[model samples]
Target: MLCAICRRDARGFGFAPHLIRVAAPTVKLCSMRCMDIAARLKGMINPNKHEAAALDAASQAGGVYVELLSRTDLTTWSEQEWGRLVDVIVTEYQDTLRRAYADDPPI
Candidate 1:
């Protein structure tokens, strides 16, 4: 499928969650870059140096993204950029839901 970001023949097999451009379509995409942020805010009030510390590295990078959001005034940005942002957000969200219910029976 085409990448929402580059519109190229993306490594992402289809129009899926910000399916990051990987080396190949056969490769699975990661939930880490996106979920690391959620995991941190969900409970980790502070950066943990414990077993979950590995997530801290990714979470910290996610934190930088958060900072970037607040640091910039989105209104001043162009519509194209905002639209692209929405595309990625929506894709990621759908992918999250799919994973969360993957093992559950459908009603």
Candidate 2:
């Protein structure tokens, strides 16, 4: 399966909302890199505030960071539909990115 964040071949890393009942589906990721990206995107960690050192380290290691700068437009969806919507949106974004940069060398 494609990684939820980068559309790469997954290596088993994953994320899922922790709920006692009605758990959201798990999101498989390609690597810890995409996992961190997903976490930051979900607001689980504020990378801008708490991960400065890690971000700097990644930059030094030749990692290129891309962020979704605009707010997501999910206001039309009901709260009960958010989990499915999130999954769909993430997958779509990953596919879009893959196609958009298909010819580019890895960063």
Highest-TM-score candidate: 2
**Model 1 alpha-carbon miss at residue 7, Å:** 22
TM-score between candidate 2 and the true structure: 0.35
lDDT of 1 by residue, 1-107 (tens): 43322123445232222244322222222344323332323322232232133334335544455466664577776777566555554444444444443433122
Error of 2 at 62 (Å): 26
List TM-scores for all candidates, in order: 0.32, 0.35
Stretches off by above 4 angstroms in model 2 are 19-24, 43-107
Kindly report which residue pairs in candidate 1 clash with one another. none
RMSD of each: 15.1, 14.2
CA deviation > 4 Å runs, candidate 1: 1-71
Give me the candidate number with maximum lDDT.
2
Q: In candidate 1, how many clashes are counted? A: 0
